[model samples]
Target: MRRSIGETVILRYWNEGFEVQLKCQVEYIDNRTQMVIVSKQAEVLNIEFRNIYETL
Candidate 1:
């Protein structure tokens, strides 16, 4: 699903013996870069995905 700014997303990742539950805002979704940029108030976050193909 394509989320928008101020939307809360569910993030699940277990790494380094730690689990994080992050509620962030979707700042931008870049099709050219295949990346999802999020923001937590003042912090900017970047997420990357490797898919066979992307949808429009």
Candidate 2:
């Protein structure tokens, strides 16, 4: 499944050996790098597109 900027998604990733999930909105996408920028609350994160577990 392809995701686009401005879409709401669930980002799942590993942190401190534990799985963490965050609800964020896609802020930007770098197709060349296959990286995505998402924002949750006041935080912004740079993540791989594949790390986006689900769309909401």
- The best candidate by lDDT is 2
**Which candidate should be chosen as best, given TM-score against the real structure?**
2
- What tens-digit string does per-residue lDDT give for candidate 2 at 1-56? 24557878777765556677888888988889988778988999887766555555
For candidate 1, write residues 1-56 as lDDT tens digits: 36554576654444345655566776777889977777888999776644212222
In model 1, pairs of residues that clash are none
TM-score of each: 0.59, 0.63
The lowest-lDDT stretch of 10 consecutive residues in candidate 2 is: 47-56
The reply for model 1, stretches above 4 Å from the true place, is: 13-20, 51-56
Tell how far residue 48 is off in model 1, in angstroms: 0.4
- What is residue 11's positional error in candidate 2, in angstroms? 2.2
Tell me the whole-model lDDT of each prediction, alpha carbons only. Answer: 0.60, 0.74
